[model samples]
Target chain A: MESTRPKWPWIVASALILVWTIFPILWIVMLSFKRPGEVGNQKGFLPKHWTWDNYRTVFRTDLFTAALVNSIGISMIATFAGVVFATLVAYAIARLEFPGKKLILSFALAIAMFPVVSLVGPLFDLWRDLGLYDTWPGLIIPYISFALPLAIWTLSAFFREIPWEMEQAAQVDGATSWQAFRKVIVPLAAPGVFTAAILTFFFCWNDFVFGISLTSSDRARPVPAALAFFTGASQFEQPTTAICAAAVVVTVPVVVIVLAFQRRIVAGLTSGAVKG
Target chain B: MAAITMKNIVKRYGDGFPAVNDVSLDVRDGEFMILVGPSGCGKSTLLRMIVGLEDITSGEMLIGERIVNRIAPRERNLSMVFQNYALYPHLTVYENIAFPLRLAKRPDEEVRRRVTETAGLLELTEHLDRKPSNLSGGQRQRVAMGRAIVRQADAFLFDEPLSNLDAKLRGQMRTEISRLQRRLGVTTVYVTHDQTEAMTLGDRVAVLRKGVLQQVGSPRELYEQPVNLFVAGFIGSPSMNFLPASVDGTSLSTPLGRFEMPGEQAAAAVGDRGVVLVGVRPEHFEDASLVSEDKRARGSIVQVPVDVTEWLGNELYAYVPYEAPADLAAQLRELSRELDSDQLRTQAVVSLDASSLIAEGTEAALWIDTSRIHLFDPATGENLTRDEDHAARLTRAAEPSRAAQRSTQQPTEP
Candidate 1:
């Protein structure tokens, strides 16, 4: 009886969403496999002829290779530094009693809500003046600053949900403060820290405005910026397929990270370490 | 085992309000001491101060012979059971019990042996591998007890550990804790707002009100002779009844019948304060028909209309409502507000033998032992009838319980 009706509305709605989201990726992959002569070919969406030339072309360019290395290195460093700083500041905001705790939280929220594009102009001038233009440090500094607000807000909410009595219980059970935090508090907060690291990583990795505004060369330019200046192997060739292949390449790590920690991320977001 | 001493301990928050004000106490070695009071009475604050979980504004605290006023909680060598149990959710029961030993860097074999023995003692042998969330409330409480007992520290502190359990579970754990403390003979301090736990569990009880220590004595001492009106009302179950009374040359006038005060008693009642509060415990009253002639000679009888009667097979409780003047009723209401009691009715409860024929909405003759009456100064709230030497006498009497517990304790593996 329960299965008698055909659920046409949900099926149609799901089909529409699937098409809306996947069509662009399918188009990109199809463009990457198309022959050089089929560039912007109007015969059909599918390629009449397939080739490995696009992937081979992407591998041959030193600009794309160097930008890949820069993206991985810069994003990794920013995520580590941001998560560490956020954990300390979040612990203080959640647990300690000082004079101006509300002000600190308000200031962090303000920074999170600020426009990233508005700051790029001033940052560009400052980086050039400080001899930091087109450098790895130049990109990493702004990434850490922008990503810290997200990490602090997420981690502090998680820290506040922990049962504070456990700390005192640990002390009474004969543990020093440092030992109590390292053994009892850290294990409970691991999921939250991992979630915060993932979020910070995605923020730094997905950034385009700061990458383009702050860097000029392959020495420190991330993939998002380096893709815009791609060149063909010869004067008559177009770089469309090569750019498509590189875009799909840079997206692989994100998909892998999201799939690996998907369960923990969902649990960390829905239920904190606290129980009734 | 070590005795704990606090000399003039005080705690004040930033508002300049004292949570625990100038309190002094000495818990003897291997004794079970209960601190009982209403909420906001600073019983928990005092316990926290002893465990070094809280800072002392200005005082000296000693564990055995060492001055530990500035010591950390872990260095004080104490184990505490929090009200919420505070078990680590990520660990199994065995790991929770073994946490302190691991932190202390005990050998692996020793840790396993101690955790197993402690679990067996708590009757949690089948639950060693389960986490706290899977256990029942009673089982979680036992795991908390196991964690504290496995350490064998200088003392054990309990902050209303039974408060979160159901009534049956609380009753069961109360006895469990009492037996465990007796069997271990560790110097222990427990804090609770429930007076029944104080009466049944403590070798000696300390009663507090509004950050001040009111009385410290044996349960019988606090019951038979409370130090003030606050202690009198705070210690008993149906609480002692307070009624305004005026004293003439020799006789006292109250809602109850006038009674001739003995010469010395009259002098104490009439000292400085012209008016006094008369306190009568519920059990001190009896059915007038059940009293013998000789017993009647030492008591006073009053006929009151019974408002309600509850028969409990062995005993009967008859509540009699009376009229109090405007000022006296207001004062009683103020006292009730300070003590956080639910009702401030002008009623007297009389406990009579079940065989008595007192019924609701009928006038019954009730006889009270006049010699057991306590007189209090209405202004100062001081019990003029208090025995000044009771605290000293209690200390000496506590020695026998200590000796008995020591002899009864089972030997542990050294």
Candidate 2:
């Protein structure tokens, strides 16, 4: 029945969704190329005069440059720590039969669903008291905590898909339990690990609430938070074009990462581990 | 290679259910031993216990001289081939076979030398660089065996390793595994539910029933002198047919007809019981027209209407349905279910020469070999006609040849 249906209706619906989601990104790219004074003219969707001057201004500013460095450092550190901890926790959840396993899983899920806005006020006061305000650790801690539940959930699911016999076979082949996990189970769970790491990195990179409320200066301010503090070259002009350029810069890495690992993120790595 | 001995090995799960209940067996050095039974019979559980994957609840498991009940699987040094051929998908065939050696921290040159030799023995040289996903089921199974053989472990355990292959490949791999086991001369304990594999590959076979060992013997002994009804029914294909019979002096009254047994045979079969079950192999019944007069004198003849006949070129099968008593019919049904067969009715399947003039819905004269028939006490399911002396002699005869093979191959062992 599906094969007999006309193809154009599906094609038309897909094109509509594509444009609805992609238009804002295309508009931002166009706005980034427009002249600084041209945003408020309201003449057309495309720029009347194309220029690289806004991009140059974005790079020349000390605030945006330092925030970019902070964003990369914090996101990378948080992703690494989150994935390492999640792998161990998820393996325990998937393979071991311990008491309180269900409680731990539910608690992690409740924490994931907890509102970020509610914690921002308490965390801000706590960071200040601990002398962690306006520091990289201030933002990194929350990013890792938030990223962990998601990473654990994804990794545990992948670990469950692996056949138990693979590890048993390895153990019978003379591998210690640790070696069985590191050499056999870890390689089998690589796709899940990669997917979890990418998700955690994105979560840390795109967070706004903690990035904005936790830090007061460029010392630990990420790009998403720094964008709100941008100003024009002088009092008469607006910073819309320069902000658009900075948005494009941060968005590039996310796009490249998804594109590069699209296969690994989606492929089921345990396909040939056992007969299906 | 070393002998593996299980002294009353028992495995109980957390729920306090004994999955393997007091199974004690001896796997001699450089011998191929098979554990066979229907599903859920604890054959695989026993194999796992031998390899230290499942902890023994109470018993001693010894590989060579060490009591290994508390030893880890890696420390026990026995490799296993899983039913699904659990090859590491991420590794090449070469690396997959070399995994154990690498885990042992072997040097690069030795790992290379041993893996190449094992791959060559398994005929996996051309697939050295290919991942397991790219290989066929048979190739993957060979890679799994290569991995087990490369370790030079104390023994090898196989848990239905060829169950996943297609029928033709299964036959080929069966012979290959048999040949490999013979060449390596490693003590092996293979678990399978398939009786044909049990009959063909093992130097000795052990049959289990619901976590209890029923009988362990040479396949010929299990066939000719089964200790009980379960062993008789489980060992044969187109298995032995059971018919309820009532004994009167030297004659037996069955659903088919009355047959006279010799005096000595009748005394052994009629042990304090008026009613007994007679077990007859399918091939023991022959078409009356095809039998010689002298041979016919040694057996009884019965005339029955054949309900169905199937000709398989070389032989013919004639199904003769009969009216069994209600209680005996239910008993046979339960036995059939336990044997993994669904026999819907009480019928005798008689195998005859293909040239016999037997057709559906026709009365045919079938000769039953009275000398070969077994009588069982229906209440206890015990074989009244079992000859223990003969069974022991059969097993004893097989020992010397096995010892000869081991001694001849000793010089080749490194």
Off by over 4 Å in 2: A1-4, A268-276, B262-266, B401-414
Backbone clash count for every predicted candidate, in the order shown = 0, 0
Task: Name the lDDT value of residue B377 in candidate 1.
Answer: 80
Interface C-alpha RMSD, model 2: 1.9
Task: Assess candidate 1 and give its lDDT.
Answer: 0.87
| Model 2 C-alpha lDDT per residue in residues B1-414, reported as the tens digit of each score | 999999998889999998989989999998899999999999999999899888889989999999998999999989899998889988999999999999999999999999999998899999999999999999999999999999888899999999999999999999989878877889999999998899988889999998999999998899999988999999988899999998887788998888975458657667568899999999999999999999999999998889999999999999999988899889999998999997999999889999998989999889999999998888888888888999999988988876676566554646
By TM-score, how accurate is candidate 2? 0.96
* Pairs that collide, model 1: none
Candidate of highest lDDT = 2
The local distance difference test score of each candidate is: 0.87, 0.90
